[model samples]
Structures are given as structure tokens and as C-alpha cells.
Target: MNMNVAERQGDCHSQLLSSHNARDLLNSVDAFLFDCDGVIWKGDTLIDGVSQTLDMLRSKGKKLVFVTNNSTKSRRQYAKKFQSLGISVSEDEIFCSSFAAAMFLKVNNFPREKKVYVIGEEGILEELQLAGFTGLGGPEDGKKTVQLKPNCLFEHDKTVGAVVVGLDQYINYYKLQYGTLCIRENLGCLFIATNQDAVGHMTDLQEWPGAGCMVAAICGSTQKEPIVVGKPSTFLMDFLQQKFQISCSKMCMVGDRLDTDVLFGKNAGCKTLLVFSGVTSHSTLHDPSNSIEPDYCTNKLSDILELLGP
Candidate 1:
């Protein structure tokens, strides 16, 4: 998931910034957090200026962290994709909702004996696996989603540890109720969420509530707070700051979404760069309903390179 920062283009100077200006900002940053979907790639195609911006930043000795609200793929998967796009990145430089979740699990003593009862796609499953944990699927009681079904968490696997919540295209009332009950029983099995995005239904106007909805169900039902492993949370920023040794002040968060990316940067007290390559557009900037604002806005990532003053 990415945050939207509505665009209001600045008047960039006609002349490119000197090496000093470029390095000045580079020197000011301690870390850099970027959203992957709109700012970097849309589908399998990489956006313009992404490679050059990254290269320029890298050449300036800036530390970069690719932050995405997407929890569907593992770090390895992301790294491979970036490599395929001819962009150089390491798994260490990537952080997703799943990464935050794995860190939370390890910090809390999960998978030692607790198994996750997953309610999301395979991405969360892979994340749990890398964290030295195993999970089970909900009971196949001949239940079909997008319609009707009975509660299933009661049918939790004997080795179930926590109820893992991810993205589910075919969610139904039964899944929600069952998941709520699982947390209620105090199996001590926790509720872990990959990412709590409101844009789960981007492909469809229905705007289906994502795992965050399920998380709300569990929290409402059991009054138990599940750890959120995504942007807008300080964990991802902390991870970047710690891993990259970038000073928080010199860092910037860049993304197309305002809620996830820009808000996330604001929370971390870092500079924010909003791009309109995807998801969000300039119209959103003037809309009061959109309760977010970024420090900078650009039509494309390339504009950032364009704005570097001498």
C-alpha cells in the first residue's frame, strides 16, 4: 500500500543543480523510504526516472529503503523482481508489511510452538515461513465465501499459534465471525496482520475492506490489539534507520498514496515526496477529505531530479 500526496508542482529552476546541491540534500538525509507500486513500478513495468533517481541517490551515498504497504510478496520475491527490472536492490534494503510482521513475531516468541491460522493469500504464509513459523488454513467445511458459511476458527488446527490475517478475495461473514472468536478464546494465539490497507478493492469499486477490517473485527470482538506490520507505523522507519544508519532528519518518504506513504513520513518526522504516477492525483491535494499532506509534490519521480537546484 502507498500513501497519496496530492501534487502541486513547484517551479523547478531551468538549470540542473550542481553536484553540491545534489550532495547537499543527500548529506541532509539519513534514510530514504520509497513506495514501490506507483513510484517505482506499476504491474511489471518500472516507471520513468526510477532507475536514474535511485542511481543518483546511490551515487550520492544516500541510504535507501524500499518501503511498501504490499504484504503479498516476500523480500526475496521483491528483490528478484527489482533485479529483473534491471534495478539493483538487496533483500536487506526492502521492507514490507510482511517484514514488519516477521520482526514482530520474532520479537514476541511466535512459531516456537504457535502455528498461524491464516486467512489471507500465500504471501503472508511465506512471510511466516521465513520467520521460523508454520501455519494452517481455515477448515474446509465445504464453505464458499463471497456468500455464506459457518464460523471456522473453532476448527483451528491443534497446533495453531495465532490467527494470521492477510488479504482474502473471497472473504465472508463466517470468516470474520470465526476469526473474531479465535481471538476471543484467549488461545493466547495472537492476531497478526500483514497490512491494513483501505484500498483492498482498487480493482473493483466495491472497495472491500482489507485485512485491516478483519483486524478491526478481532479487536472489536476480543478487545485485543494485533500488531500492525505496515507503513504509518514507526517500525518500518525504525528498521530503515537502524539498518542503514541514516539519520532520520536526512530521510524522506516517497509514494503516490497520501494515507500510507505521506502520513507515514509525517509520523516518522521525515521529508515527504508525493508523486502522481499512480493511485493519487493532483485533484486530491485540494480536497479537504484527504487528511494528508506531503512536503513536496511532483508529477513524476523525474521531477525530483529536475528540482535539484544548483
Candidate 2:
């Protein structure tokens, strides 16, 4: 799954544009949604010229929003990171997986008396709180342990109506045991995940187990799949559309990954752009097994600047 761009060489869609034709592609959309990490930054470092490219897009009167599947940070925290990188993004312009999970529950009319049992981190908890939902069972008691056996009942929280999973650095038998119990024992306990990305991007150029790894453990234990709220799911797009009243025809999704970012754009009826500065490689795009394709492909996000007329 981790093919290098050079190794995965193949023809992309016919929509591929050069510097000359790039301007026309840019003219086709009024709004732009970007993925963080691979697309904008690599860990704590911002991608070269990313700030200028975003500024250029904003100056062109294009609406911009940062969409990330990483549930480790809240919108406020994400905004702080943008500011730290000299990119002026407001919290309102950010939509992360944590927010999407919270919104999904809210729209479903999740019970006010019921609380969500979280297996993630503070970001998820904060987002749930911001959406007026109660979350428990995260780092507050991550160290708490309980021995559970097969088909054995343990005293559990009766108010837990949902089991939401994302990335948890402290994920242990305790969290997994409780999460499985909530899904197996509790009636109508909704299962949700931020993303299914197996390998997360890191600055060290090493692959780390993503949120999907944790979600997989729970799935294996409970024999249930979670409703993912991140990329490739139109839930976030639907939320953005309803909240911003923006038309998909005027929107474009730009990112480095294909399965999530490109598929997400395709699902939401937005133009998709794939940049090689991240996880996806040209060969991976060419892989016949890969069904997702972007409207355009470039070496890096900065390549799109060529579309910006002088």
C-alpha cells in the first residue's frame, strides 16, 4: 500500500493539466478544501510555500477550508497550529474528523442523557463538548485497567450510548475491553471512527499506526464496523455544505492522498487534485486495483501556483 510515486508510474486521468492549462482548472472552482499533514505540512513542519499558496488562493477571492482526518487536535488547536506556521486560518475554516464525529452524532439526534465513550484523546472530547455532547472514558482514566474475559459481564457505564474511536496513543487492553463491551452489551450503541487510514504521516518519514489500527482492534473484538466520519465519507462534506451553504460545483479538494482526499472529493461532487508531496505516488494511481482518481496531479501543492497568473 505504500508505493513510492516513482514506482507507481502510470497514466492518470485525461484531466491532467500542465502549467499553461492549470489556470483554466483553477478558474473552474470558487472554493477550495485542503487536507493537512501530507498536503499542507509534514508533522510540525509546513510544506514549503504552502502558506503563500494559501494566501494566493485567498487573494483570488476563493473560499478556503482546511479538512483533516487527524482527530488528535480540535479546531481551536488546529487554528493555533496554522497561526504557528504563519498561515492565517480561523477555527471556523477548519473541519477535522473530531468535529465530524461530533456533528454526525448531533444530526442523528443522539440522546442528551446518553454519553459517548471515547477511545481517542482530548481533541475528540473537546469537540464533543463544543457540540453539546458528553464524552467519557478517554485519557481522564486511560490508565485505569480492568480484567475482562470472553462472554463475561463487567460493570459498565449505563449512560454510554456510543463508542467513538480515533487515534489513542495510550490505547491499551483497558480501553479496548470497555469499548468492545459497550458495542456488544449496549443496545443501540453507535460505533463511529474518525478515519481508516492504516499508516499515518510523520515528519520522520516513518509510518505509524493510524487511527484505523485502533478501530480495527475494536472491530475485530466486536465484529462490527464503525461509521467513519473522515475523508472518503461525505458526512463531513454534507456538514460543510449545510453549514456554509456552499455549492459543490464551486468547490475543489486538494490533497496528497487518493483513497481519502480524492475519493472524498469525488463523492462530494468536487474537483479533486492529487499532489505527490504526500503518501500517494504516481504508480499507486496507476494501479488498476485503485478506483479513485483525481481531476489533476502535480508534483507538489506549490505546482498549482503555476495556475496563478502573474
Candidate 3:
């Protein structure tokens, strides 16, 4: 019964002609954009065939780029991790949301040389500092502007260039309230967030809150929509095109999530390929009418190689 149901539901890929067609089309693809975390590897372990398939794609002369929302590490660190995984990737090939955020602020004229109050994690804070945004109320000056607690608000610093939000494992009420106030006081205060992945890596579905969660809370309090520059934001795409001279027409975003990965490609005017090896598993690939569909779907990256046509 399960076999029959699975076949009936997912036979789109099983169809011999459709499978051949997708492979042929994918072979013609030039630039391949990948999403990390769920798409390439779930948590720490490498997803099977990932390394080999990427190598294969590279051998086929297709340009590769790994675009991720995970800002916990820099591009250099991510490249090292991929190298450690036997997947050869250069630092220039990786694009993280944190990097994009910093670049976005820099490009958008985010008030250079300002002491900014941050309500995010180390990754974000590091990028802000690199971009010249100083930390306010941090322990450096032995200052304590706001106490950590639920529904707490920190005193505002006049020099906040923007209220940037990312994955905060140690978030509290004070951070949320103060961050929102920064946006509310001036709707033009420049709001930014990482990504909107609600749940991640766990059983019993103990989904952790995403940056979008904080953005939502702040938006609820401030009536301001964040300048989302993550997946589907086109900021990264813009960065890529400007850096590499790759046309948007020849780019393809190959990821595993429908909401983020696929939507990113669709919004950025790139082809979207949904691989079942990551976040949105086979079961979640149902209800086609539910919105957020990819241009092509495959069970594995290796399967994409065959699409290169005979």
C-alpha cells in the first residue's frame, strides 16, 4: 500500500521521459547555487552523494556556488569545512546571509561609524563590527544598559544604523523589546534579518525559532517590515552577478527547501531545482497547490548529472 501510494504521488520523477527531460535540461545549466545546512548536509554529517555530485558538476564545467542562511561561520570557515569534507570549494564560492547583510548595509549607506545596539548572536555582531558598527551596552565598557529577561527593553542608543536580527540562542525579552523600539521610533531605521527557517534539526519536531520569528515580533511591535536580505532576497544574487559577471539567465538555485531555496531562485529570476536530500523531505513535497514550487525536482544531486544528456 505504501509503495503504491508513494508511486502515485511522486511518479512525476519516476516517469522515464520526465526524468530524462529534467536531466537533459539540468546538464545545460551553467551556474549552480546550493543552500547549506539542510540542502548539502543535515547538521554535521555529510549527505550521501553530495561531494561526488558536486565534483561531477564541476568536472562537467558548471560553475558552483553555495548560498546559505547560516551565518554562524564566515565564508572562509565554510570553505574549510567543505574542504575537510572532501568537497573542494573556494571561499569566494560561498555566500552567507551574514556576509550579505554586512554588504547590504555597506551598499545601502547604513550610517558608517556608529555605535549600534545589537540583539543578535556572535555571527551578526562580528559582521556588524567588521562593517564598523560598534556594540552598545556590551561588556567592553563595563556598561549594562538592559537586563536579560522576558519582555524587557534596553535603552536606545542614538547611533543604531540598523536593527539587524539573526539566530540568537540567548535571546531575551529585553533584546526583542529594545530592537523593536529601535525600528518603531524611526520606521526608516533600517531593519534586517537572516532567514525565516522556522524549524531545524530535531526530533519530536522541537522546532527552534527562526530570525523571522524575532522579525515578526519586532514587526508586531514596530509596524515595520524588515529589509530581508537572505534567501529570495536577491541581495546575494546581486552580489554574485556583480562579483562573477554571471548573468541571472544562466544561474540555477539548487536547494532542498521549497519556501526558501526554491522561492529564492524564483524571485531572483533563476531556475530552481528541489532535491529531496535536504530539509523539505519527500513527505513535505506533497500538495502541489500549496504554493512555492520549483522549476525542477530530483531525488539526488547525482541524478542531476544524468540530466546532462547523452
Full ranking by TM-score: 2, 3, 1
lDDT of 1 by residue, 62-164 (tens): 7778988776677988899899999999999988776677777787767577666666655666777888877555334216453344662334355566776
Scored against the true structure, residue 205 in model 1 reaches a CA lDDT of: 24
lDDT (Cα, tens digit) per residue for candidate 2, span 1-310: 6766545545346365587667876788888999998889988888887887888888889889989999988999999989998888999899999999999999999998899999998889999999999999888767887666688556678779999899888898888988898899889899999998888775546568889899999999999989999998988987788767889978999988888899899998998888888888876777767778888888778777755546
On lDDT, the stronger of 1 and 2 is: 2
Better of 2 and 3 by lDDT: 2
Poorest 10 consecutive residues of model 1 by lDDT? 8-17
Instruction: Give the per-residue lDDT of model 3 (tens digit) for 51-89.
Output: 877877788788899998875566767888898877888
Question: What's the TM for model 3?
Answer: 0.82
Per-candidate total of colliding backbone pairs: 17, 4, 5
Please state every model's RMSD to the true fold in angstroms.
Answer: 6.2, 3.6, 4.9
Tell me the deviation in Å of residue 285 in model 2.
1.0
Pairs with backbone N, CA or C atoms under 3 Å apart (clashes), candidate 3: 23-307, 24-307, 151-173, 152-173, 152-174
Best by TM-score: 2
Q: Identify the runs in model 1 with alpha carbons over 4 angstroms from their true place.
A: 1-27, 138-154, 170-178, 200-225
